[model samples]
Target: MTGIALPSLPAEVVDQAIDWSIKLTYNRADASTMTAFDAWLASHEQHRQAWERVQSLGGRFAGMPAELALQTLEKLPEARLRRRQMIKLLSLFAAVGVGGMGAREVTPWQRLLADHSTQVGERGRWTLIDGSVLDLNTDSAVVLRFDESQREVELLRGELHLISGADAGSPGKRPLRVATAFGLFEALGTRFSVRLDQHGCRLGVSEGAVRLTPRDGTARVAQAGESWSLSAREATRGTATPQEVAAWRDGLLVARDMPLAEVLAELGRYRHGHIGCDPQISTRPISGNFNLTDIDATLDFLAQAHGLRLNYLTRYWLRVSV
Candidate 1:
């Protein structure tokens, strides 16, 4: 349920709730402790309600990799959590999703209510009102803002493969732009793909050209067959093959001597939880065509091909080691 649906309880009840959470999570509660907790719960309806909220707060940890989840929770400000853990409970009143609670992701309202969005391990497409086709890759969000003046798409996260459509009424008069946190991608009759993450945005142009204007006010042009690494201030040109650019769209990952760590990171995009690489073998070069939709097959392939080991800490946590 949304936070608005949950009523507020007293501060003391909330404190007890957090205390119970820490004890149960970090300590083995003896029979006496359980008995005491039960009696406490029975003593006041607010206590029971607060305990329920505490449990619900952990709901976001469900299905998360054990280590990743624990690490994220550990990153929570210790003093802040101890003092206001109840309010910090994502289920209680956090406006953002669990992603923001501790995982450090930004889920803006624009992305939350985007015209087109997809979850992890999901791929989808949408035909905009003006007939443009947008293919969204896993864990992606894109918002389309089209009006009488222009056609605009804002990519909040993940990646997008866009095929611009003509403005049937007056194609010449309509201008199209794709905006990211760092800058703008102005379409010049092009087909392009864009991926965004903590580092910045990676853009590949397949046909025609794109003019990018970074937040720092520098402008650069990327033509066909060229890829650009765009950060907040500038765009650097690079090489990209069509197959390399379009592989994920066809449910495949194309690696051309990419680092094992890089490959694992790319594959992690399609799988939930953590796909970790041992520091010992992360620099190993890996090159192959891998299926994107079958994560198990990919993992199996990695193990068999590279003589690596897959250690499953939990269904949600995996460690690849040599």
Candidate 2:
């Protein structure tokens, strides 16, 4: 048996193709639709590749929870929100333009608008159209767009905390939603946080209830003090410890017998520099509450209290030694 080969497309072209799909789906595509689309796909072999790349963009909508995506997408402001975003992008272009560097610097908002991402150690916060708030942890990114019928937020990277609010005018409308790497978390007027890691994703509910439905079909309900880790195929339930989860918001680092490697990973989120532990020492247990504002002091305390030594490869790279 032979496996079918998938087509490869350039990412930029793929993004443009998805933008075209959004325009077409929203009735923003002009009468030159077919002509323009055909010309676009015919421009080069890569153009066709790009079109094929985006052909599956709407696959999530097939048999998708319409009510959920609708509510989520509707929370985003109008397209006019792009104006401010574009201005930011223009500044980057101007800087590159002045520097005479042909290379372009892509802003987080542009990649975010086009369904891209943020690099390591970057955090962002955004307000939804319905007055809901979203906070993206370090290295996080999300895509948002609102239509007359819905509000939607698609997590592209890292973790995001969402606080859903009551619909200002439409009292009986569907609830907002957040889509992550592992599954969909439908916010029912609640406060929740979802984190995506290399292993999979974790969801922790702070208040109210959230429906956790896997992209593959299985579903579970998570309430306050509950947490679950989900992969594409399964979900495992765990107890939610709010102090551990919310510690970041308070500028503190709290861990409970977590592995040294994992502790370092969390610490990395608070600083612009790098921190890691020796692989042999990674399995060592770590437990403590350290202030994030002074990471050097935190590291110093770890060495004094835990019999560990901190080594700096460079100002930005750190590692733990025994």
Candidate 3:
């Protein structure tokens, strides 16, 4: 799939967009090149939108490390690279825009056409066409690609709880499968939640069973009340109490003796911006059920109860320290 077109964008389109980006930003463009670029835009309405979106990527990198981003930018061919363009070029290198990337990150087109998606701090559930329910966690997305041959759901990001549904159109029960970058999960008439992270996927099963097939190794099956971590190479069986798995759906952030850093990371998902703690406090373990809907109030109360200081650099940047 490396050379193949992204599910949301054609290969030629991405190549052409990249070419245009380079011409306008990195390379000197003559009058003829400008005319040709305009002609390309006239050729397809999407080309114009692509150019706009590409030009808009630099601001996202403002917080990135200067040395790391600059080093990457210096490798580019741009003679006079602006700060914003550096980040935009970084995005290009990381396969953020257009295609060339994996299926984990949802493309712009996918989001526009996604049957169901959620924004930061927002959660939702969708009753699928086949009568099953798919619950989306905060800042998540999933795409449904069902057909006469198979029923499949692709997890783009974040987490989801998928309950197997009945497809009346099929003679037998339709096979329900969830796909992610780490592996493929096939449901055996059960209920489960899948969380996508940087390295792999975490799966929690409350009822029934699921078989996980890693990209490079043997498949492993977890029974009801079981959990597992799936990487590209293997599935490591783990434990996740059903309560912990379903707590988010109930508007609570439940952590049981989990490290303070991880707890903050979980809380950060429901709130905006940088939420962190001092290195000395990072290892502290916390256990509680906090409100998810009103996270700021919860954090404020917890700061008082835990004898911690809530530091706010700005409305978006927050830190909890002892």
Whose TM-score is greatest here?
1
lDDT string for model 1 (1-322, tens) is 3325566676667788776645533332333344455456557777767765555455466456545655556554321244245334433323324532212233445467787888778899888777678999987888888888889999987899888887787545588889999899988988999887665788888888999988886999998888888889899887767559778999999998887777877887787644656665666888889999989788998899989989864464466877
Q: After best superposition, candidate 3 residue 280: deviation in angstroms? A: 1.0
Candidate 3 C-alpha lDDT tens digits along 1-322: 1343322444455456656655443322333344455456547756644544444444344345656867755543321345655555665544433322111122344356577888768999988888889999987878899887778999987889989987876877778999998789999989999988867889999899999999888999989988889999999988667668778989988888877767777877776544666656766778888899988998897788778988863465465777
Say which candidate scores most in lDDT.
1
Cα lDDT for residue 56, candidate 1:
47
lDDT of 2 by residue, 2-99 (tens): 24455555556655655554443333122234335545654678765554433322232333344553443333322112333323323323333321
Rank list by TM-score: 1, 3, 2
Q: Give TM-scores for every candidate, taking all chains together and pairing residue i with residue i.
A: 0.69, 0.61, 0.68
Better model by TM-score: candidate 1 vs candidate 2: 1
| Alpha-carbon RMSD to native, per candidate | 12.9, 18.3, 15.4
Relative to the true structure, how large is the alpha-carbon lDDT of every model? 0.71, 0.61, 0.70
Which 10-residue window in model 2 sums to the lowest lDDT?
97-106
- Global local distance difference test of model 3: 0.70
In model 3, which runs have C-alpha deviations exceeding 4 angstroms? 1-113
